[model samples]
Target: MLHQQVFKLALLSNALLLSIGILQNPSLVQATPSYKASNSGVPTQSARLNDTLIIPGLRFGPITRTTTYQDLVKMFGASRLSDHDVFGAEGLSRLPGTKVNLGETRSFLVAWTNNSRTEVAEVRTTGSAWKTQQGIGVGTTLTELQRILGEFEIPGFGWDYGDVVRPKQGRKFKYNIPILYLSIDLKAAKRYPSDYRAVQGETTILSSDAHLKHLGIKVGEVRVYFDQPGMTSAE
Candidate 1:
């Protein structure tokens, strides 16, 4: 019985010592910095290209020309602009699209015209990063574009913008309608692989593989513009 009493006293003494130690140094009971768990609850990265189609008479992804600068930052996350960065500048392109800076030397210019206080007029790009809902974008071969858009007219200047396509046939108000205008880099298309050269245009009749190689045959850009009679210009 004496030995059992001594064993009980030792167990109680250990519990009391532990409680006193915790009371004197409360931090010891607290979670350690390294042992503490956390969750950011947000994505650290995003897609490389916006991939949002520049739909005419509609919306460009989730934004438009009138999307305020603050909303733009909120939607696309705050831009990591540089000291020399030129945002919404005109020198970027011949059109009036405002450049929205996406960090790391990438951007898309949102332009407007017709003094239409509504949707964005045009979305232009010189890069091959972005794409449309139809999977058309820069680096798409003329043959691929033909397969996608179907029955488009070639521009007078050869592989360039100003190539217009009607949404429908025979309309008196067609002149005032909005048409799809493709902006292409003729020089880049001309340099595409031999297979891409097989695509034929209205003026260029491909008789042989060699002739096809010499034809300008790739889509380097795409634009949706409103036919504003004497207002639209090619770059």
Candidate 2:
């Protein structure tokens, strides 16, 4: 048992070393590897959030919950997806729901559990206005996001949409919540199959301290998605 643990530690250390090397080089993480980006916020495998996806400048204005492709064309002027297969992906779908301020909300997100290859995605099924904590214009609709992102997907556990809330300083809802994901499923040859489940009663953490007022949860609500990874990168 002791030898097994030592071997595991060694393997972990090697992985950490590899990741550090990749980060320091920066070139290895560049989108297109040898090409510059065509637009802003459209991250390739190389482009990563310097801070976090939840960074302050990343929020947009909120529109009605029922957004569509025409809204994206009007706002972005062109489409980046340029493909049909991406639309069929489960990672690209979000249920219809309005963005609201839950008022000092506290919640947690679980991406993977017990070595489960779970991931999260931000999908907008309709064209809606999204907002930030400061209530600035982020963008309108999912296609708008698609133009900015090109095409990509992340394996996730589930989402935390309804748990979001507005600030005490604002009277109306100021934040537009993008769909949150906890787990993701993938599709197979002619069919969608495969799933990743979250660790039951697993520990969780939050970036907000004032919202919790002092309590951090060791477990949280779990959601599931189906049909991811089963498809190749959009082409």
The lDDT leader among the candidates is: 1
Error of 1 at 91 (Å): 12
Poorest 10 consecutive residues by lDDT, candidate 1 = 168-177
- Most accurate candidate by TM-score: 1
RMSD to true structure for each model, in Å: 28.9, 21.1
Q: Compute each candidate's TM-score over C-alphas.
A: 0.44, 0.20
Clash counts for all predictions: 2, 33
- Name the regions of candidate 1 deviating beyond 4 angstroms: 1-51, 77-97, 103-106, 112-119, 158-213, 225-235
Model 1 per-residue lDDT tens digits across residues 1-235: 4433543353344334334443554443232112111242211234223334443323344444444444444445565421222222224333333466764224555554423323355554545555544555556665665565443343222332223332212112111112333333556555764434444332323222243334444554444333221111111
Per-residue lDDT tens digits of candidate 2, residues 1-235?
4433543353344334434443454432232222233353233323221211221111112111122333323323333222121221235542322222212221111122112222222122221122222222222222332333232222222332212111111111112222322221123211321212221122232223222212221112112112111111111
The local distance difference test score of each candidate is 0.39, 0.24
CA shift of 49, model 2, Å = 20
Residue 102, model 2: lDDT of: 18
